[model samples]
Target: MNNASSSTPLGAARGIDPDLIAGIIIVLGAGALLTRTSDMPGMTALLPVTMLSALIVLGLLMIGRCLLRRRRRGDPEATAPAPLKVFDNARRFFGIVVAIAAYVAGVALLGFYTTTAVMIPVVAWCFGYRSLKGVLLADLIFTGGIAIIFVVLMGQELPTEFFLR
Candidate 1:
């Protein structure tokens, strides 16, 4: 009798491997940390370093949890359950990376407001926000609130497009 439970095939046709996903997360997080550490200490550098460290720690914790769960269950394979369908998680993470890249690129070219305006809505939609109105509303609230606090109230100088002069 085959007493072992079959491994859950989570959209294997999409060619997603859990180990690969973990590895990618580890690599990207490490790269971010390295890049940030090489730069002068500033708000920009500090933020990325902090975020990278958090991501690395979170990934490690998740991997450890999967290992522990597998051991506790006495599964012979000891493979962790895939929390997200491989392709979906891949797409989600990639989207986030792309958005971050876009933001960085846009800051100098398009200015803060324009970049953030597009990024906020795009990211929300990527995370399964189906309603266009809801996404737009969320973006407007977030962007507008930040503008009010930083630009109007705090008197901070935000980046502006050259053409606006």
Candidate 2:
């Protein structure tokens, strides 16, 4: 009898590989720590401090779970299958590039709020968010929050074009 259920599935479909996730988390944590430790001007220190602390804590927790699993199972051979190469990952990166390009191109013409507001939904849709309601919700949340932060709190001048004005 083929023990399909008993056999652990390989690859991305098998869900997140604990070891790989832990390794990534550890690397990210270390990088964040290094960045935080480095001398930077003004508020940059806050960015790294918050990011690094969160990353280190999360990484340690993940690593701890993996170690516990290893000890309990006692199966040194328990290995996750290799991940699949997906265009989605590449597409997401490309989407970010597209957003940046669009932002730069549209800054003077479309203005910050308009360009960013449009980009968020468009990018969300490109990244597999199908529902219009969900896209709108995300776009509103992101754009509104950014607007409040930069324009309201920080008092930064956003490009308010003819359309927005």
Which residue pairs show collisions in model 1?
none
What are the lDDT figures for the candidates, one per model?
0.67, 0.67
Which run of 10 residues does model 2 get worst, by summed lDDT? 6-15
Residues 1-165, candidate 2, lDDT per residue (tens digit)?
355544543323344444646567686857756665667655545545666777777777776766565454444466544443434377666868777888788877888888888877777777678999988888899889978976677666668865657
Please estimate how well model 2 matches the true structure, expressed as its whole-model Cα lDDT.
0.67
For model 1, the local distance difference test gives: 0.67
Cand. 2 TM to true fold: 0.50
Candidate 2 wrongly placed segments (more than 4 Å) = 1-18, 29-37, 42-44, 75-119, 154-165
